[model samples]
Target: MNLSKFDFTRLKNLLPSSLKSLSINPTSDLIREDENNDTEFYSTPRFVHHIDDRARYVLSQFYTYAIQQTPETITLDLCSSWTSHLPENFIGKVFGLGMNELELKENPSLNQGYTVQDLNQNPSLPKFSSNTFDSVICSVSIDYLIHPLKIFNEVGRILKPNGLFITSFSNRCFPTKVIRKWLYMNELQRVEWVANYFLQTDTYFNPMTIKAYSFFDGNFLPITDEHYVDPMYIVSANKK
Candidate 1:
């Protein structure tokens, strides 16, 4: 099925009005995970793609569209790994920040440069100067954030005015590492959770858009019964 033709209303209706009003203490167990040491957990290099190929293609298409929409000069892939799912002929330089050193070094997508740092330990992007990147992307890794507010603020600081920050996620994740708040909420609420991350930071422009592109329906079954494909959703905002 064509991506544009996919019905998102069913998913949209699941979002609660009180989602934005919801709050949790940053140190609460709701955001904590079974494995606290992210560095240790990510020590072993896992080169595998978290989402399936079709989902990856869908995400890459969205990334391409976002890049074209904003026309980035330089991009940063936060919590990135071996693959960024970027368009093949992307014009701008792409940098990666990840936990595993070997994974960052091996990533073909980070043609420009790459660094290894645990954002949980130091939520601040001290390595990069202020206003350095035109675009920032965090793909499928938002649920793993323990200090999302601080990280989002850092993203806003690093982004130039009017720059875009695109965050995308799917149904799949390492459950043990995913935060309790993320695990408990359904997909639609998870979308709002990301949006709230942007809103509460007060560093990005308002009216952030939440979008969904699913190969499956409300039942979590594939529309075409093609190999199971994970649904993709994005929440995006511009730096003020």
Candidate 2:
């Protein structure tokens, strides 16, 4: 997969001009937050999904199918929130870990556990037993995480050797909460950034099987959909 497996065919032209390679931005212009850091950030809970309706449908479709690919057993949704897009009959146990108590409470899908783990200050996740889960799913919140390498490393630590991590995100995000490093990266660079997360941690992620899909597939959702999107990135990396 040495980077080639990341199918950006549908996204080559759409990639933001600002990014074209593995370049790093040492400055914090694009990274700068107009919002004041005085706020505790997640002090208030957001009980809503980030993407529009159309995007949500597409996101749901991905979730429904992803469940089929993996076994019906233990699953972890790190940086998880209320309303995880799991199939009705997933036959697996779903564990959600996020910041908001109200949001997690609203999610009827959470089986028994709802833990909170933030990656900005503490990169280490709470649950640990080494390769314990069959799947690790992160929804549209990947951009919000500052230390992806650390998070991904912890993901690898929790996932069973053959388990997979489904990291998906769209163009929409909370500007201030997202890290400066991610804010500066374009689509292609974003993919590389995520892949490099696995690389940096020396995880067992299989790059050869890595793939990216833009939701712009033939069927476009009505403009009324809640999600905001130009392109999407969904990658599945298997734990070796």
Candidate 3:
């Protein structure tokens, strides 16, 4: 995609009011924790789901629909874990690229292959050739990326033309690992931030769409009840 042809005005108009006011300082210190080593942070494998059950279900529903919409036979799960949330009937080969080998090995969906690599240290996926995947997904883990734009561009390069790149997140994250921009922004603003990633990278098709699904009674509002449900948000775009 041509960077000059990007319609920033149209993209800005589509964003929420909160996102319009937020600014991204690319030079800022994204990681707040004392430990910068992601390997150490994720050293002990936690065989557990990050989000709640309801949020997982919503994510699964979205993933199922996304896979059905496209001809995705080979999928790459970036920053993946033990569970990929793919539909049981999905007949595709899912590959896992994550920090922990144990987590990737535990994932049943990654029957095709799996690799242990840190995107923060190296954003590029040199192992895979260009246009190797039909779809790329990063579930509930976008906030941890310090070099998100580089990773986004890598996603564009590896995906076939018109292939889908789906990024889903929720209210939960390791506070120290999340970037300052993501940690400071509200849920709506964070949606725009992810959209800006797709736009600024100049790798995705125009008119990036953002969708929010609340775990609280299916309403868009955040869950304020005692049950403590996490609200899910998705920002998706097609490779140009």
Candidate 1 lDDT by residue in tens digits, 1-240:
566554333434233444454586766634665756889999999989888776777778777776733335889999999888887777787899999888888888797888899998889998888888888999999998888888999998998887788888998899888887887888877877887787687645444433333344445565557755677777777887
Across 1-240, the per-residue lDDT of candidate 2 in tens digits comes to 112233433333323324222443435522436434413677587777677555666656666666534345778877777778775655667888887777788787678578875566677876568878888888888877655667788888888977888888876777776767777767666666665555555556755445455565443555557542435577666787
Reference-based lDDT, each prediction: 0.77, 0.66, 0.76
In candidate 3, which residue ranges exceed 4 Å CA deviation?
1-23, 69-72, 208-226
- Ranking of candidates on TM-score, top first: 1, 3, 2
lDDT of 1: 0.77
lDDT of 3 by residue, 54-167 (tens): 778777766776663334479999998888888766677889999999888889989788999988888999999898888899999999998888899899899888788888
Candidate with top lDDT is 1
lDDT sort, best first: 1, 3, 2
The TM-scores of all predictions, comma-separated, are 0.86, 0.77, 0.83
Steric overlap count per candidate: 0, 8, 0
RMSD of each: 3.7, 6.5, 7.6
Global local distance difference test of model 3: 0.76
Q: Pick the candidate with the highest TM-score.
A: 1
Give the 10-residue window scoring lowest on summed lDDT in candidate 1.
7-16
In model 3, the Cα lDDT at residue 56 comes to 81
